[model samples]
Target chain A: MPVTENIYEPVKAKLTNIIDESPLIKTLVLVPEKEFSFKTGEFIELTLNGIGEAPFTPSSSPLVKDKLEITVMKAGYVTGKIHQLNIGDVVGIRGPFGKGYPLEKFYGKEVLIVGGGCGFAPIRSLLYKLIAEKEKFKKVIFCYGSKTPKDCIYKTLFKELRNIEKFQVLRSVDMADEPWDETIGVVTVLLDQIKIDINNSLAIVCGPPVMMKFGTIRLLEMGYRETDIYLSMEKNMSCGLGKCGHCMLGDYLVCKDGPVFTYNEIKGLPDIWR
Target chain B: MEITVESLKKITFFKEFDSVTIEKILKISELQEFDVEEKIFDEHQKLIDIFVLLEGKVILGINVPGKGKINLGTIHPGQLFSWSALFPPSISTAYAFADVPVKVLSIKASKIQELVGDNDTFGYKFMKIIGQTLSKRLSDTRFQLINMASV
Candidate 1:
């Protein structure tokens, strides 16, 4: 008889650092008892022990095996508890679940990334991977938006991204409470600022639902094929293994089938933006 | 450097116009340039020219009593602004400033009004474009309001 491993069991991870990203968002750096790994867009079920569990995509580089980072916005019960946690506190992590971005498809193509708010967490990880293999892609363009200058995350990362060859970073804020030098309006407006070779490009959108919807529409208008636009869909995923029907979308389960999907794969799915 | 019917056709506001209509527009339009931080228009100022951004950024804001100029949004290339010039009681609603070195196609509003009064078809198409621009700005403003209220 062959022994089977329990899938429900979570690997213990200890909080090592917490960086305040914004007034409402924090990035928790965790050191897992055992090495854990995941692809850039895949999610992990972060357990708060006695409190509860919530699904989050690791914000750290997947190439880094020992330490994982999860950026959390305090929006709900479990996430609120996770925000209150201190350094050295133990938490459980259940997965590196779901499919991530298809890097092979992105090779030899121009990659355009549109992200807003907390959605930058996953894209940041993806950026790390793309930067490591920069020679494979033709170019990378990133457009990001926030409600205000203060709401923007990873403030220092933008400077570093601008310094890299073949990488162009553009940012915008819906409203400028302070002096902001970048483009302003919604994230979609930044699409107009750059010249893209739509015939040889892939557009990736990850943001709040409104941003995602408008970003995808803008990309379509710019002549990108449906198959060339990728979206990160964050649904209410309960069981990351797909046993729970909580994250179902049309005929597919978001957790098992995707957190990342090409727009062509789920265009007519009901209430996808919601 | 030169303002022509062909150049106007490339602008979003004038893209749908016929060559004759664009030529009429060109007769009343001139290329204007502004340095960074230059104030282009002020809220409540009597308007004379309607503008289309040909290049660089423009910041639109309202002057608050104590908080100073509260930037509502930015105007990107190929966008129309100061449309208040087209209506009666032509008073600017928001102050416009160049956030970067900028170039714009400034059209005499009085000439455009005369053109609209003479040609109904031109009037309808031109007004339709302005209406669409207003609708998009309204939607963008509403989205910003919701974002301000959200977590």
Candidate 2:
């Protein structure tokens, strides 16, 4: 076994590479000072030394130990600064924290992952994990949406994956233009285009709060049991340890309890999904 | 193109209605087609008919003051579009463009209003579906707005 850094102490990391996903979005490929490991759906707090830290999920596959990746959209202060930083810059990393998607439960069943915008980041991580263990699952349906032709991310990756014989990737844009050949609509609309055996499948939805709500509603209406639906609830997780109450959903701290939760577990908690 | 009760029954939008009733509704409707990228209607245009997509895709967008067109949603097969045509002060709220060659069933607003006036039973069923479409779109649009909010 190799030595690992303390969980609480932030470790140094170097941004080894960068890919411009969109004008406002970038994927930072970093090499952590120590080996890094995170289950699908877990998140990390990236530090800019004195600037501050924000939580993001690694968009790369966990099976790959050589490097880690985080796809960030330039939305807030921390992310805007991240967008401006060069490829060789250094940052701090503090985790593999929080419970991740229940990979064990997904074995031998169909998995449908629906995500929109930057919310698709964590789902991308989970998708890669599932792709690596292809024989374990019966089927995988991934539907992703963006605002426009220019706003979609993972274009190259999706183009490649679509060529694979087994991966089912349905993409839509709120609006599309010339040279765009995919579906045009919110990602949820993709749900209507396919047939899912709701009784034997699970739906993992992570996206804008609004998208999650509607997507869940659509799934429920389609006969998917609430218990089988998993959601990634986004919150301001300042403390990776879950000690901070910033990410609370009633008694559950999103950082400690979940960045990933079954719809049944959180459905009873009022407005947590709101 | 021609629309009959048989064709109308095949559309999910009118699936709930039986042959006789759909036939009544079909008298006021006409089958229309749009080529890719054609403007089905523009924001603020007079809303003369309500359309139900029979095939292909339609993209909806609202024009911003200086930001150009921002897409709001898409219409798929068997889904209803241009609900504003059925309401008062009828005018489009967004621009709908055909993303692919599309076939749609257009029902004249005046004829639909007359039919609804004459049959209270079918009127309720018709209004209910429109209400559901409006509610669903309102909710999806709300999410779109929230997701587009700063940061």
Specify the highest-TM-score model's number: 1
Candidate 2 RMSD to the real structure? 3.2
Q: Tens digits of per-residue lDDT for model 1 on B7-98?
A: 77887777788999898888888899999999999999999999999999999988879978788878988899999999989999999999
What TM-scores does chain A show, candidate by candidate in order? 0.98, 0.95
lDDT of 1 at A255: 89
After aligning candidate 1 to the native by TM-score, how far in Å is the CA of A225 from where it should be?
Answer: 2.6
| Weakest ten-residue segment in model 2 chain A by summed lDDT | A1-10
What tens-digit string does per-residue lDDT give for candidate 2 at B1-151? Answer: 5667787787789988978888877787888999989999999998999999988988888888887887667788899988898898899999999989999988898898888889898889899999988887776666556656623
DockQ-based CAPRI category assigned to the predicted complex of candidate 2: acceptable
Candidate 2 vs. true structure, TM-score? 0.86
Tell me, by DockQ, which candidate is best.
1
Backbone clash pairs for candidate 1 read none
Candidate 1 residues A1-274, lDDT tens each? 0011556788898999999999989999999988888888999989887888888988889899999999999998999999899998999998888999999999999999999999999999999999999999999999999988998999999999999999999999987878899877888778877888999999999999888887888789789999999999987789887888999999989989999999999999999998
C-alpha lDDT values of all predictions: 0.89, 0.83
